[model samples]
Target chain A: MTITKKEVVHVADLARLDLEGEAIDRFAGQIDTVLAYVDVLKGADTQGVSPTSHVISLFNAFREDEVGTHLEREAALANAPDKDDENFVVPRIVG
Target chain B: MKLHQLTLYEAHERLKKKDISSLELTEAVLDRIDALDGEIGAFITVDRASALAAARAADDRIASGSPAMAGLTGIPIAVKDLICTKGVRTTCASKILENFVPPYDAAVIEKMKAQDAVIVGKTNMDEFAMGSSTEYSAFKPVRNPWDLSRIPGGSSGGSAAAVAADMCIAALGSDTGGSIRQPASHCGVVGLKPTYGRVSRYGLVAFASSLDQIGPIAKDVRDCALLMNAIAGHDPRDSTSAPRETPDYTAALKDDLSGLRVGIPREYTEQEGLHSDVSKAVAAAVATIEALGAEAVTVSLPHTRYVVAAYYVIAPSEASSNLARYDGVRYGFRNASGTDLLAMYRNTRSEGFGPEVQRRIIIGAYCLSAGYYEAYYGKASQVRTRIREDFETALEACDVILSPVAPTPAFPIGEKVDDPLTMYLSDIFTLSANLAGIPGMSVPCGFSQEGLPIGLQIMGRHFDEKTLLRVAYGFQNATDFHTSKPKR
Candidate 1:
C-alpha cells in the first residue's frame, strides 16, 4: 500500500501536527513502508479470534469515591508555559 | 577501593558495618560521573548538591541507629529520564519536555525515596522511549561504554551505560519492546522486566502502555533482585497495579537450578538475521544450564514472526492516544507563532516532537483513523492474542524459555537510524515476551569477536520472576561474564 503526500498531510492534521515540505514526503514514504509491513496481518486467518487490548487479566478496578488530597492549584500550573493565577493562558479560541 | 566500583549489595554491606558512609559513596559516584560522562552522555540531569544532602541525611540516620534501615538505604541510583522524579527535571529526552519538572513522584520513585536511595541523576533516553537506539534522542546520543563509536541499544541506553561505566551503583529503566533488555545485553549488565502490572507505572511517560514496564539495570542478577524488592508492589494510585502479594525476590537467588525445565524456543535461534556469535553464546548458555541439572527441551512459539508487525500497530495506537495530552495548554513546550488555538496545537507538536516521534504519531493517527481501523488495529489485536496463546502453550511444556536477548550486539551509531523497519526488526526476539506479559531478563552470556557483549534471555510465566532470577543467578555463578568490565 502506497501512502501519498495528501494522506500524510491528512493524518498529520488529525494528529495536530503541521508537516512542511520535506517532512511530508519523508513521512509519506516511511509510513507507507511501515504500513506495508503490517499489511501481512491480512493474510493470517483471524476468524473467531478475540482481540486483545490488554495483555494482563484486567477487571474494573475501583476505590471509594471520596475527596482525596491532590496536587494544589499552584502545583498543577507549575509547568505551564504560560499561565495566569488560576488558569493556563492559551491563544484566544473565540473572537 | 573506589566506592563507584561497588555493586548495590557490596555497598550496602559496608554501609551496615559503618565501614563506609553514604556521603563517601555518593561523592565517589559524583566524581566518576564528572570524569567519564563526557564521552558516554549517560545523564541529562545530575543533581550533585541535592544528592550530597540526601547522602548526608542517610549518614545521620545510620549514626542515630534508626530502625528504618532498608536494603537500598543511601545507595546512589540514577533514574531514567522517562520516570518522574519529584522536584527534579524529568525530560523524556525530547525538546518538548526539556524543562518538565514534575511535582509528584512516580510510584517507583516514591518507593526508592522511602528507602532513602540517593537519586544522583536522570539518565538520557530516546524521546518518550520511542527508538531502538539513543541516536533518536533530541539532546544527544548515548555511546556504548565498551566502544565509543557503537550505539548503546536503547531507549534504556543511558541507564545501562551508567551501570556499565559505574557512574551509579544501578539505575532504573523502562522496557517497551526491548528498551531495557536490549541495552542491558549490549552493555553487559543484568536487566529484568517483570510481568505486566507487577510494577506500577503511575508517572512513567507513556510510550506504549500495554508494552511499557519499568525494570532494573544492574551490575548483577542479585542487584537486579534487590532493586526489584524495593520497587515492586501494589500502588493504590495506579489502577493497573497488581493486587497480588509481593515476594522477597532476593530469596530466589539460588545457585542450583536442579529441577528447572528450560525450554529452548525453536523459532528464536532459527531467525535469519541472528548473529552467529550470539547464537553460539546462547547455545553455550543452554549447555551451562543443562550442566546445572535443568532439562533443556525444544518448544515452538508459532506466531513469532507476526509479533513485530502486530506490535508496531498496537503500541503506536496507544501512544497516539496517550500523547494527546502534550498540547501547549497545561505544560511543556509551546509555539508562539500560531495565532489561534488549533494552529498553536499543530505548530507546538510539529516543532516540539522529533522526527521519529512525529513519525510514530502519524502512523498511529493513520491506523486509528476512520477508514482503516479494523484492517490494522483489529487484526493486529487478534494476532496479539495468538502470540499470547503461543507463550501459554510453550510454558505448559516447560518451566521457563531461553533465547538471545537481541539479534546482535550494539550496532554502529547511525547504521539503522534512517530505516525504521530494520530498526524495529532488531527487537524481534524481545517483543514477544512483552506481548505475552511474561517476566524476562537479560543476563550477560559472552562477548562477540570484536568484544561487544551478548546476553542470554530467560523468560518465565506471569509473576514468576523468581524462576527467571534463579536461572540467571545460576548461569552468572558459573560464568564471569557479568564481572568482566568494559576497559575504556
Candidate 2:
C-alpha cells in the first residue's frame, strides 16, 4: 500500500512533470500520505459496483460536427505569444 | 459613473430609461478597469475595442426595441479564465495555456453575448481549478479585497473578488468542487452551482467535467438568479444540457417557504475539524433560517465522511486524462528544444503547471492507472452512490438542507499552502452536492468577530435551484448579511 520516492518520480514522469531534489522527497511523503488515504478505499466491499465515472447518468454531451464560423485569422492570432501569418509558432519541433 | 459599483439590475433600468447609454456603461467600466486593474490584478485580458463594440450594439438593440436586451443589455460582466471566450486568452491560470485563445466561446459566454451582456475581461483562477486558495494559480494569486494578506478563494477567486470590489457588475465562474461558492463565501458575495448539466459545458476548459458547472457570482441572490436565467438552458451543442424547460427563478422568489422543512445535516455540523467561530456563525445562520418559518431539523448524510474521499478520487482520475491534452502541441509555453516530443511534453507541463496542479495530476494518474482503477475509481463510485442515496432519502423528508459552505471562513493566504490534506478538507461540505449532481448555493449568513464573512450553504434536489433561491432570498430578506459589504 506504500509508494516509494522512486515510484512517485515515475508517476511524475508519466504525468510529464520533472521533479527534483526536495520535490522528489517532498512529493514522496505527500504521495505516500495520499496513498495511505486512498488505502482507506480498500476496506469497502464493491463487488457489484459498476465504475461510475460520472455522477449524473449523462451520455454524449457534444457539439454536432457542423462547421461553425470561426474567428478570423487576425482574432485567432490576437493573443498568441508568437504567430506567423497562418500558424502559431512554438519552439522548432522540426527534426 | 463608476462602472464597478453599478449592479446589473440598476444599469439595466438606466439603459432602458435612456438616462444612460450602453456605450457609456461600457466606457465607464472600461475606464474603471484601466484605473484600478493594476492594483487589483483581477483580469488576465481586457478586450477594450470588442467590449465597446458590443456595448454600442447593445445600445442599438435597445433603441430597436429588442426584448432580449431588456433583461441584460448594457450590463458589464466578467469571465473566469477557465471558460472559453472566443478570442480571449484563457490561461486557466497556467502559463502552459497562458497565450491560448479558444477558437470558440463557451455556451454560457455565447448566451451572455446574445443578450448583449458586455464581457469586460477574463478573471484569474487556480491553475486548472485545483486549489481552494488561488495561490495555486500560475499567475499571481488574486488577493482578497477585504484584506490583501488573505486569499480570495480559489478557481473563481478572481471573479468573486472583482464583484466584491466593484470591478465588474457580475461575472461568470465555473464551479468544480466548490470553486464558485468557496470563493464567493471568502469574498462575501453570492455564488450558485447549478445541478450538474443544468448549465452547458460545451466550451468550458474541462477539469473533471462531470463535477464542473458554470454559474454566476454577484452582489446578491437575485442577480445570481438573473445571470442563471440567462446561462441555464438546453444547448444543441451540449447533449447533457437539460431539455428546454424554463424555470422562472425570479418568479419563484415570490413563493412563500413559510412552512418549509429545512434539514441541517448533523454530520457537517459535527465535522471534526470545524473552527469554533465557524460553529457559532453557522448556528446563527440556522437560527436565521429557522426564524424565517422553516423548521430546522437534524438530518444525517451517513456517508458524509466518504464524500471528499470519493471526490478526490474521481476528480483527479478525470483530470489526469483531461490534462493529458497539454502536451505542448496545442498551446502555450513550449520548452526551448533539444528534447524529444515526449520530453518536450514533460518539460512544458513541469514548467507550465504550478505545484498543486502537478500534484493533483500525479495523484489522478496513479489512481486511474493499471492495477488501481478497480480499487480506487470503482470503490469511490460505490461510495458516491451511497452518498447520493443518503441525500435522496433525506430530501424525501426535508425541503432543503442547510450547512456551512466552508469549515472556516477565509484563511490567510499561505495558512494551508504547505499542506494538501488541510486544503482539500475545506471542500468537505461542498463535494457532496457535486457528487449528488444536485444544485447548491452559498449565501452570506453572518460575519466572524474579526469581520470575515460566513456563508450558509443550502442544498436542493436536482433542478430545484428555484427552491434553493427561494430559501436564500427569504433568508436574505430577514438578514442584512447579503447587503453587508467588505470595506476594501
User: Which candidate ranks first by DockQ, i.e. highest?
Assistant: 1
Model 1, B9: alpha-carbon shift in Å?
0.4
The collision pairs in model 1 are: none
Off by over 4 Å in 1: none
Q: Per-prediction DockQ, in order?
A: 0.87, 0.45
Worst 10 residues of 1 chain B by lDDT: B60-69
| RMSD (CA, Å), each prediction | 0.8, 2.7
Interface RMSD of each: 0.8, 2.7
Per lDDT, the best of the predicted structures is 1
Q: Write the per-residue lDDT of candidate 1 for residues B1-488, one digit (tens) a residue.
A: 68999999999999999999999999999999999999999999999999999898888878887756889999999999999988999999998899898999999998888888899999999999998888889999999999999999999999999999999999999998888999999999999998999999999998888888999999999999999999999887878778899899999999989988999999887898999999999999999999998999999998888999999999888898899999988889999798999989998998899999998988888888887888888888899999999999999999999999999889999899989999998999999888888889999999999999999999989999999999999999999999999885
Report RMSD for candidate 2.
Answer: 2.7
TM-score of decoy 1 = 0.99
Docking class of 2: acceptable
* Residues A18-95 of candidate 2: C-alpha lDDT, one tens digit per residue: 999988888778777776776666665556756555666667666658888766887666655557888876654667
Model 1 in CAPRI terms: which quality? high
